[model samples]
Target: MEHITSTPTAKAPAERFTGDVYLNMIEAPASPAHLASALVRFTPGARTNWHSHANGQILYITDGVGLVGTRDGNVVRVSAGQIVKCPPGEEHWHGGTDTTLMAHIAMVVGDAEGDGTTWLEPVTAEQYAHALSSQGGS
Candidate 1:
């Protein structure tokens, strides 16, 4: 057994995030392990871009309130102690709400096909507005 050390927290890239988001690497799929995870924190109104995983993704909320949305324009509000699952190859985005900070442990599985996430364009203002509407602005 190995005692895992903490990795540096990094700001989510502008090309892949709409606002300030930070992530700390929890695991990175070492030998014999195909699983990787990160502890991600989002500032109020911050969110991720359109992206997908070849093997899906799992998010375990750890703090504050957030929202997860899909390409279909559906948005779901999530809070601490909640879980959000993204199906394989399904494009989606997630982040903090307009007035709440949010954090989650994001986990994913890797295969020989690719790394884990395929990032696309950032989520637009209109889309975020729709998300807020879906959440009733609360």
Candidate 2:
């Protein structure tokens, strides 16, 4: 068995994230064949921008609560022990809710090169407002 080197924590881009967010590489293909995972953390009000992947992506919530948005105007609220998936090429974004710190294991599947993670625009205030309204602001 080979050992995987640990990398220092990287800062999330201000253009994409709103609050303190961090991630750590867990298992990579080099360490375990065909396996890759990341431990992600999002502070209150932190979230990702609209984006899509060529293959797909999965989010396994590990703590607090999280939220996800789809292009078709669907906002899903997820909590610990919940799992969320985004199909290939489906524009969406995920992150912490308004007043909670969210964390999850994000698994990016398929090709590492053309795997496709196209980052789109950030979640606008209007979009967030609409999402909250749709969910009764819960």
Per lDDT, the best of the predicted structures is 1
lDDT of 1 by residue, 105-125 (tens): 999998654447899998998
Off by over 4 Å in 2: 3-7, 28-36, 112-115
Per-model TM-score versus the true fold:
0.93, 0.84
Candidate 2 residue-wise lDDT, 1-138, digit = tens: 878788667777777666788978786544223456788899877788888877778999999987888999888888999999888889998887777788999887645453346888888877876776676664
Q: Give the TM-score of candidate 2.
A: 0.84
lDDT of 1: 0.90
C-alpha lDDT (0 to 100) for residue 132 of candidate 1: 92
Least lDDT summed over 10 consecutive residues: which range in candidate 2?
Answer: 27-36
Model 1 lowest lDDT segment of ten: 108-117
